[model samples]
Target: MNAPARLRVAAGQATSVPRDVAANVATACSLVTTAADQGARVVVLPELFLTGYAAEEWRHDDSLALDASTGSGGPDERLRPLADLARERGVTVVASAAVRRALDASTLSAVVLTPDGEVRAPYDKQHLCGLEEQGFFTAGDHGATIVVDGWELGLGICYDGSFPEHAASAAAAGATAYLTPAAFFTGSDHRRDLYYAARAIDNGIYVVFAGLTGTCGASSFSGGSAVYDPEGRAVARTGADDPAVVVADLDIAEVRRVQDEVNTVARDRRDSLGHRERLEVGRAG
Candidate 1:
């Protein structure tokens, strides 16, 4: 199927009720409805939003993580509400949660809930931040892309977006946009501006960053959720520390324009992206 020439997307910034999956899901449903009403075909939510970004909470109480076993044909009961909402609203909802992939295994995963009521966790966060996350969640093996209305969106979570190779891999995989669900802290404005925009410009694709707001455990999130165009311009954005939803119409043609015409970064990116040689430059003594 041919991708849409222009696709409307949204980034959701909301507060997470610590250790409360049901409440968080309910909150996400409301935000999803808002985005759908705004004509967004896809809405991306914050990281670990299902049970909050409380890594210690997850570590202490494993029950907080939803069972997302690979063999399951449908979402678990806890995930059904959001799935039903997506189907009813005909919007693709990208949400994240701590998931138990197996009895002994758990990971922080971003799931794509399609309008057809299908749910898939195409990406598990590869880069875990700090000791809390590193001690609690298992890192994913690789990056992945999800399709909504024929628009390919590469998936990442928080720290994963900081790595240039992560977004570059998505572009190489034919993704027109990169979606990141994050929980950035209050003083990370410089990071929020640099990382998302850099990823968009570096890959010559749309970048949607959905961040958390308010407090989740010991940390306070700055909800600088935004959507950056291919040229790294902020097309849509929410105020820092504000709980809101921001939407933007991403023109796929603009991606082509930047990649092929204006920005050659995407077009000129070599396949040896993973290949790097350390070079030493010494001043002539």
Candidate 2:
């Protein structure tokens, strides 16, 4: 018989520090260590966690602008310690940081760090909101995925979660779980919860959304870190504006069962017809 595929994951709702890389890294390290101690094999953090989600701040500061890591440029020096912690604790961590893509000097990206301290797949935000466009960060070309503990995981940032294509492409790529690290602001909780649940139901996969809480600069984050099961059920969740680590144990077999039962319907399609049409148009372009 195949080994039972069960894993315990943690969603870290942290307080981000705008323009403070060292302090943010320190907080992330501490959170990872704490999550590992709690037997969390996989820990997910919020988007642009290291430098907070203050896109406006990056626009004015030269230091902050120069500090972004190009997704392919490997890990940042400040984040090396967290990588070391992951190696030491044997926990697979998914954290986000403001990254600069070397290929296009005009773009800043979000990256995922693997357990072995290596830069895993990078999912640039395809949807930029408000001041993000003014910050000069270009969108990513395509979505990406990572495999951990017999599970295919998809990566997306805050705004990326707003788009169905991001999660749909990952599911089509055989991802059983969708992981999003976000810094969603106030009044956005309802939308976040709705999207997460909708994504799970539509794709027949688990959705884990880790968000930042508390205030950073002029923005206040709505901390509703959540984990949705394959059937669009929120198996684990935290209250609004709470800073805590939410843990959930997922059974991969249930995901398979749900897909077989609910995903066979035409309405539960893996590829939306609209998305397919767009892909065809882009290819022909």
Candidate 3:
């Protein structure tokens, strides 16, 4: 079999229309088109790009109800056209949407759309931040790793990035790249920037992070969408306040080189030690 194609990924960072599902979907489609024109093989949009991140307002709005797709049906019918666009352009599109999980009546979630327009398995944000999303959304029980064009891709939402375990778990699951769709605020931008880079270093994988800009509800987002190489170096980054598409030609070969140099995975072999520690703790108790 021929080797998988090396993907040129684009992280589309822009201001979203809060509570405006139609406009948001249109904007995302436009961005995807633009990215395809620019020769991007894979495009990643911000978390909850379709409805913005106004959790409480979105949860109550009835009009927004139409945008929510059942997990089994793929993307909403309105957004179905995007899937055709992806196929036409031959680009794997990863866009976020506010969705209703059919399994539980009370649960609303965020999900990713594949280029074929299929909803890849959903990864609801496992950790909700502050009061905004706490009661409004239900945390997802599992994480997903998708392979697109031979690239092992891991998915996570905004608050999920703050925790090391989330990225670590993805890395452990053989993810070569971690993709985060975030709506990060101003003061927290620097911390997030550093944390993403650190996660790359720790996991020895590339990180493609996109964040929303402008104001959503009472919160203002910092638009520092970036791509980090396996060595935890920023290969390409946008300004914290700029609305633009950040593109990077990632070298899959470099991933292996860095992994060999750092050897974090090979050297950190304490698997048996963990069991020993647990046993010791049990005895002590």
- Top-TM-score candidate index: 1
Whole-structure CA lDDT of model 1: 0.86
lDDT of 3 by residue, 124-240 (tens): 778777785776666788888777777888888877878878888898888888888888887887787888888788778888988888777777788888899888888888875
- Higher-lDDT candidate of 1 and 3: 1
* lDDT over C-alpha atoms for residue 123 of model 2: 67
lDDT by residue (13-99, candidate 1, tens digit) is: 889987787888889998998899999999999998987887657754454434465622457667789999999999999888777
Candidate 2 error regions (>4 Å): 1-4, 59-74, 102-108, 263-285
Q: Please report the candidate that would top lDDT against the real structure.
A: 1
For candidate 3, give the lDDT.
0.73
Estimated TM-score per prediction?
A: 0.92, 0.85, 0.85
Tens digit per residue, CA lDDT, model 2, 81-148: 87778888888888765554444444334555566766553666677766755356776777778777
Model 2 weakest 10-residue run by lDDT:
59-68
TM-score of 1: 0.92
Clashing pairs in 1: none
- Candidate 3 Cα errors over 4 Å, as ranges: 1-5, 60-70, 102-110, 263-269, 272-285
Which pairs of residues collide in model 2?
69-100, 70-100
Worst 10 residues of 3 by lDDT: 61-70
